[model samples]
Target: MLYRYGSLIHRRARLVLVIAVLLIAGAAVAGAGVFGRLQGGGFDDPGSESSKAQRLIDERFGGRANLVLLAHATGGSVDAPDAAAAGRDLAAALQREPGVRDVVSYWSAGVPDLRSADGADAIVLAHVDGDATQRRERAGQLIERYAADGPALHVRAGGETAVNLDVNGQVARSLAIAEAIAVPLTLLLLILVFGSVVSALLPLAIGGIAIAGTFAELTALGAVTDVSVFAINLTTALGLGLGIDYALLMVTRFREELGEDRPVAEALATTVATAGRTILFAAGTVATALTALLVFPLYFLRSFAYAGIGVVVIAALGALVVAPALLAVLGRRVNAWPVGRRRASRSAGTAFWARLAGAVMRRPALAALPVVLGLLVVASPLRHVAFGTPDEGVLRPGSAGRQVADRLATGFPSNQNASVDIVLTGPVDRDRLAAYAQQLSTLDDAALVTSSAGTFGHGTRAGEGNPALSRPTGERLTVASRLTAKSDAAQRLVRSIRSAPAPAEAYVGGVDAALIDTTHAIGARLPLGIAIVVLATFVLLFLFTGSVIQPLRALVLNVLGLSAIMGALVWIFQDGHLASWLRFTPRPMDTAMTVLMFVIVFGLSMDYEVFIIGRIAELHGQGMPTDEAVRTGLGRTGRIVSAAAALLAVSFFAFGTGTVSFLQMFGIGCGLAIVVDATLIRGVLVPAILRGLGRLNWYSPAPLRRLHATVALREA
Candidate 1:
């Protein structure tokens, strides 16, 4: 099938080139709007209990106060006449803004909690009305309008919405920086690998086409659904990385076939029949692994899945269709300006890779044990893994939102925005609500609890007769206790509130509650996500290799490699070992980012696995002994796999240069996993394990064998 497609493309090369040009042009135009269309945040699960509570609060209490403007007095306490007057004016102006609501400040409400501990700063808190995206937009404008240094006071915008805006901006800058570094470095490495400037440029061209198509597709997807701005980083990295990978394989095979003195069309056909088939299988595996993220409810995870699948499909098409047409046109000139002697067709049982494979085959168990143990030792830090949601701290240290968060954490008694909201439905009276508030105040971690009846601290009423604590409709009352997001104390406080008796049906909603709920939602669906990935991978690999065992082995090896990568992320990011070097604050790794890395790394590991094993399987089918097949296959494909993995690793590492911790985690984690998989696992463990299994590596139950043959890809 690929041979026929390649033949048709070769025969119609000019037409294909013209169509490619047209598609690229259209894609570039359509994709230009992608950044503007994407959303800034998607960390919450809409159907979770916390979400329901948040909705009720918004409906009854005018939404959660998710925006904060901190006003710092220039010389004295905020009560100084000049600072007080400026703060009051700023608060009043904010209240008049179209989307701002419930603006509260020390000057407006005389609430002590709104004042900083030192009395030199005060907070104006308000809710930005709209969905997440709209709220971020409004917050951006408000920051521009209000965040400034006046003679009396200095004001800075900080809150969930503001943090999201900062995060989105940093990600954009990081993407630009990553591309600027990666593209040229990738070109240099490609030239070194292919030893021809002409050959080196093809992959970048294919990558550009794939990236253009991916952005255009993402823009279109954003029109119908929520797509996280974070997906853009993945699209850029994978589109270029995988595009180069597939194109390198095809170009290398074409060059080899041409080296054998085959006619251009025939060489192209043979190249497509072999390397093209591998690309299809590799793309399928990658897409399947990413598609597993669809089981997750968060748009953050789902967005990557969408972007990943789109890039894989587009990259594959570019390599299969556009790359071949380019290759057909280039012909012998593909190797023009070669830097070194061009590699001839690989000979069996002779090359350095073959010799290494033989040495490992001679001592399979001895060779395998240390690599496995070494990887396990590296992965040991996962035992201490801690999960947390990303916040303003995920941004760089001096970023506006992060600076605000740092100040708030240090100056305020507690984070009001991170407060736990206790919603009481079917409440009877003030006395009952007071009793509930008293119970909440008794918890060791609860700083204060506010209700309609009074404000309680340490189980005592600190104040009374606060009407603003209750909804005007009078059927609901809100009890708020300040807490930190994702801290153990906050999590414990949430549990206490839920288990404590209340005057009415109680629901807990706040940053802490939302964090707990989001974690649970991901955990609940995790098994299913793993199942989908595993089952899909098994089926796909069985069809590709006609052996169930090889697929199972692939999964095992991938898990080992992924374990080390996850452990390294925890050790470096979470444990703060590399915090100074990486320039990120020490915090628990984001749960969603961790899961994303797992699925993506698994898919990419399978990508290299298929390329190498498929070659070995083909050699075995041609009657080579198992050892000879392994050696010959590794000899033939080892350079290509290493080159592809290096290119991909460089792309991911470039993204690691990003200031955001989320991007850094992805960039470093994926890059390390690719390099480790390509060298340690693929080079050492795979050959050793297969050599130990010998002919059994190809064994399957008779019934399954027949089933596999029916689905297995056949060479022309």
Candidate 2:
């Protein structure tokens, strides 16, 4: 099948090139539309309880959303007239902004109202009827407008508006820095691995086109579906990584064929037949793994899964069709730099691999025991792994959000708290509501509270007809409590409130609230993701190798690799044991990140597995014995596998250099896993096991054997 494709593409190189160009152009045009829709309306649907609450608010409250800003004097009393006046001026200035709907401040509260109910701080609330991006910009302008007069009143803007603006800037900067490192480092690694500037550059160009196209498609899709900002980075990374990997495999095969005395068209055909088919299978596996994320209850995971799958599809097509077409045009030049001594035939039984396998088989217990023990020892730390959401402090210290969050943590609570909604079944007495509200003020973790009844009361209130009655029926009261902490602390507080056995049914909802629900959802569905990936791998390998045991062996080895990687990660980040050397400030791992790592690492590890198995299968077809085939195949593909793994590791590690600790942990963990997988698992362990098994590597049930022979298992 691939031979015909390569032949046709070679014969009509210009036509094939035109098609490639058109596909990319179409994708570009479509991506612009996707971007436009995304800019107009962002998708915030994660389907978590917190998101459900936010949705409820959006549905129940139809007016423009108001962002409250508090500008307090750092060195002066917030009660001073000047401080009060500055707050009023800033509020008025915000009111004049293009998107501003209204402003609420002490000055707007009529005559002589200059202090908050607490009498310690003044407040300014700005209302904006706009998208999140516009709201953030308006907040930025407010900061600039009040800058000169701020210090005189010790004015520091701290509110949802300020925090959102700061967080947006931080996310943008982190992405920019991650990409800045990822791109150049990717190119350098390609150049080294391909040993040719042109080949290295080729994949980047193809990947760039794919990304542009994917973005265009995503933008178009955004018109119908919500595309988060995070999707952009996901698409870029997926497109680039897969693009390079696919093209390199084909190019390597094409070069080898040419060296073996095949003509340009024939070499292209062979390359397509072999490497192209393999690329398809590899991408199919990756896409399948990513698609499992759609089962997640959160839109965040679903969005990532879809975008990643799109990139992988585009990358696979580029390598299978576009790359071969391009190769046909520059066939000989693709391998202009000749590698010496091309060996056409491999022996039936190789000495080194045979001996190595014998050694492993002879000491199977010794060899397997030590490796398994080592992995377990590394994995031990995960028993104590604590999960938490990332804080702004994980960003660079110079970041505005980090500085603000740090200040807030010091002055307020630990930064993990949420704005809660406490609803009552029936409410009639304003004084009783006020009494319950006063109790909220006395809670140890409550740094601040905002309520409809003016002030919160102390201690729990219990009465038959009280607004604090614990019921989920009509006529409810709501209170928004800003807690001191962010992730776990907020989660604990929410649990505490719900578990208090109080009369009123309380519902806490915020980012922390959303994360808690999302984390629970992730834990519930994570096993499904593993099962999906494993099932897909089994099917792919069973068809490719015609052996059940071989597939099972690969699965076992992959599990070991994952355990080792995760164990090491828990040891470093969870335990805070390696904070000094790695320059990492340990924070709890986001639940989503941990699950993401499992999918990504497993899919990537499959790349090496497939590559090795393909080479072995090829040699076996040429009549090499099982032992000789394993050795010879390893020798042939080892360099490429090692180089590819190294390049992938370097690309991932580049992300670690960014200010986001989550990205850093991801990079380091995956990077370390790849190094271990390529060397320890694929290189040492698999060979040792295969040596013991001998012809068992080819063993399969008669029915399966017949099916495998029918399929032919030709990847390219």
Candidate 3:
């Protein structure tokens, strides 16, 4: 089947090239506006109780204020006549902005929560009304207008909306920085690997085309759904990494076939038949693994699935379709501009990989023991792993949103923005609601609670005249508690309030409650996502290798490699070991990022495994002994896998230069995993295990073998 497709593509190489160029041009045009349409955050599960409560609060009571302008009295106290006048003027000016609503300030509202603890500063709170994109756009404009120093007061913009805007800006900047570093570094490394300028440039060209196509797909996806801006990072990294991976494999195979003096058509056919099949299975594994993320309710994760799957599909097409056309057209000219040394003759059987594989096969147990033990030792830090959601802390230090968050954390009496909102449905009993609010305020974690009766502090009613605290619309009344979002204290407080008695059916909502519910949602569905990825991978590998054990082995090794990577992430990012060097404040690893890394790394590990083991299986089918097949296959494919892994690692490592902690974690973790997988797992352990397994590596039940045979992936 691959040969037939290759023939058809080669026969119409010029036409295929024209079509590929035109498609890329169209994709570039369609994708030009994607960044502006992407969302900054989608970490909440809309179906959860917290989400419902939030919806009720928005529809019934006024929606939450997501923008805060901090006003600092530079010359005197904010209550001083001049500073107070400036604060009021700024508040009134913000209220006039098109998208700004629910504006409140200490000078206008006389609310103590709006006043800073020291009295020298005050907050102007407002709601940025619109969808995610609109809110961010407005927040940007507001920051430009309001975040400036005046004679009496210095104003700075912040809050959830401001944080979103900052995050969007950072993502865009990081994408540019990562691409800048990745492109040139990747080209240099590819030149070193291929030792030919033409060969090196082909993979980058394919990668560029794949990225353009992926951006177009993401733009379309963003219009209909809440696609996260972070997905662009994934799209760029995966597009380049996988595009180069597939191209490298195909190009290397084509070069080898040509070295054997085969005609251009025959070499292209042979290359596609072997490497093309592997690329198909590899792409399938990656797409299936990423598809498991769809089980997550958070679009933050699901967005990656969308981007990853799209890039994998596009990268594969570039390799199988566009790359083959290019190779057929270039022929031996692909090797022009050779660098350093002429391409070495692999038939000499003196390659370093063959010798290394032979040594491992001769002492399988000795070779494998240290590699396994070393991986376990490196993975030990996972025992202390903690999970949390990203917040303003994810922003770089000294950023506008980070500055506001730091000030809020230190200067405010309590974070009203992080307050947990308890919604009561069904009946309005003022006394019962007041009693519930009192109970909430009495909890050690709760600083205060507000309800229709009044605001209560530590179970005592502080005041009762605030109209915003009273619900005049319907049976629903909101009781808000002062608790930090995504904190352990806040999580405990949410649970306590949910369990506390109330006059009606109560649902808790706020940043804290949303995070708690999101955590649960992930835990609830994680097992199913893992099951889908594992089962699908098992089936795919079974069809590819006609063996059950090989798939299981692949799973085990991939897990070990990924576990070590996760452990390193926890040690460096979560444990704060490299906080200064990485330039990120340490916190728990983002739960969604952890899951994303696992699925993505597992699938990519399988990708390299398929390439290595498929060749081994082919050689074994050609009457070579198991040990010999392992050595020969490793010798032939080892350099390709190493070069591909290096290119992929470079792509991810570029993200390490990013400012966001989560993106840094992703960049460093995946880059380390690729390096470790290619070296320790693929180089030493896999060869040793194959030697130990011997004939058992191909063992399968008769019924399963028949099923596998029916669907077996042919290797030329």
Candidate 4:
């Protein structure tokens, strides 16, 4: 099948090139519309209990207050004449805005909790009326208008909407910065490895097609679904990296075949059947791993699955179809303008790999133990790893939204700005409601609780009922807690509130409640997601190797390498090592980011796994002895793997310079994983395990062996 495709492409190389150019140009133009269609936040599980509560609240009440305007007095207390006038004006201005509602402030309501302890800062709470995307848009406008220092009062926006805007903006900036740094460095390295300026340019062409194509896909997907803007980052990095990886494999094989003086068509066909087949298997493994993300409820994670699977398929197609068409057209000009003797350097590097493989295979178990132990030690920190949702804290301290959050956390006592909003539906008995509200207010972390019955503090009725808390169908209560939002303590508060006896159909929906539900939703679905990844990988790899044992070995080594990387992330991001240098807060690992890292790293590990094992399997198929095949295969593929992994690492590690902590962890972890796997795991552990397995490395059950014989594409 591959040979026929390559031959057809070769015969029609010029027509193929012309057609591909037109299609990709169209894709580029369509892809330019993608940004306008993308959204800001998708981290919440919309069907969880918190979501249900939110739905009920939006239906029963006006809407929950999700935007906070922090009004600060530059010279005096908020109650002073000038500051009071400014606070009232701020509230009135917000109330008059088109999409702003439920406006309440310290000056108008005299809510003690809305005033800071020092009396210099007061908060105006309002509900931005719209869907998540629209709310962010409305909030952005309000922030620009009001969230600035003034002669009388200073105001800043903070809350769900503001945080979403900041995160999205940071991601946009991170992508630009990462591309700005990675692209030039990658080109320089590609030139050094390929030993010619012409050869280096080919990968960029492949990458451009992959990225442009995936961007078009995202644009179409975004038009109908909730796609996160963050997915754009994955699309850019993976598209370019995969482009280089597939190009290096294909070009190297083509060059080798051409050296045998084969006709251009014959050489191209051989390259497709060989390197092209490997690219197919590699793309399958990557897509299979990413498909598991669809099981998660969060669109934030699912968006990556869309972008990742699209990039893999598009990049692989470019590598197979468009790339071959280009190569066929280029013919011997593909090797034009050489900078140095590329073949001689590869030959020298191959010899070094052969010696290293021989030394390891000679004493497989003995040489493997120390390396295995060292990796286990690197993975040890995962034992105590913690996880949290990304918030304003993920942004740099200087970010506007983050600064507002910082002030809210430290300056305020207890306010609805950071509270568990519990709505009671169906029927509300006033006396029972008062008792329930009192029960919540008496909890250790509950600083105050207010309902239609009255406001309570420490189990005592401290104020009259607020009309906003009452409704015809039921009553709503706001629990102003002492625990920080999205914290372990805050999550505990949610559990306590849920566990507490209720007077009616109580629905808890707030930042803390949402966090608890999001965590639970992910945990409940994780096992199935993991099962899909493991089972699918095992089957695909078995198909590739025709051996059950080889897949098992690959899976083990990949997991080990990924564990070491995850543990390193825990030590650095979660445990606060290099926090100052990375310029991120030391907190729990972002659960979504951790899951993303694992899947992506796992997929990429399979990428290198396919490259090395494809060569080893081909040599073995030619009746080479096990020891000879292991040494020769490592010798042949080592330089390619090293160079490819280095280029890919450059693409990822540039994100380490980002101000967003989660992206920093993601970039650094993935880049480090690639480097470590290409060197230690691929170079040392693989050959040692192969030597230990001997002929068993290719062993399969009789049924599978017969099946393999029927459909094996082992060589070009």
- List the lowest-lDDT window of 10 residues for candidate 1: 341-350
CA lDDT, candidate 3, residue 57: 73
Residue 655 in model 4: shift from native, Å? 0.8
TM-score of 3: 0.97
Model 4: residues with Cα > 4 Å off, grouped in runs: 415-417
**Model 2 residue 430 distance off true place after TM-score fit, in angstroms:** 5.8
Candidate 3, 1-716: lDDT as tens digits: 99989988889999999988999999999999999878888788989999998787777766778898988999758999999999999999999989777799999988787787899889999988888888888888889989999999999888999988888888789889999999999999888888899999999998998899999999999999999999899889989999999999999999989989999999999899999999999999999999999999999999999999999999999999999999999999999898866455333322878888999989999999999999898899999888998889998788988888778776877776667787777556777777777777887777767666777888798877355645654333334444555778878888888888877888888887888898899999999999999999999999888999999999989888988899888899999999999899999989999999998899899999988998998899899999999998999999889889999999999999999999999989999999999999999999999889888999999999888768786777
lDDT (0 to 1) per candidate: 0.88, 0.66, 0.88, 0.88
How well does each candidate superpose onto the true structure, as a TM-score? 0.97, 0.85, 0.97, 0.98
- After TM-score superposition, the amount by which residue 43's alpha carbon in candidate 3 deviates from its true location, in angstroms, is 1.1
Stretches of candidate 3 off by over 4 Å are 344-350, 472-484
Off by over 4 Å in 1: 340-350, 426-428, 472-483
- Candidate 4 accuracy as TM-score: 0.98
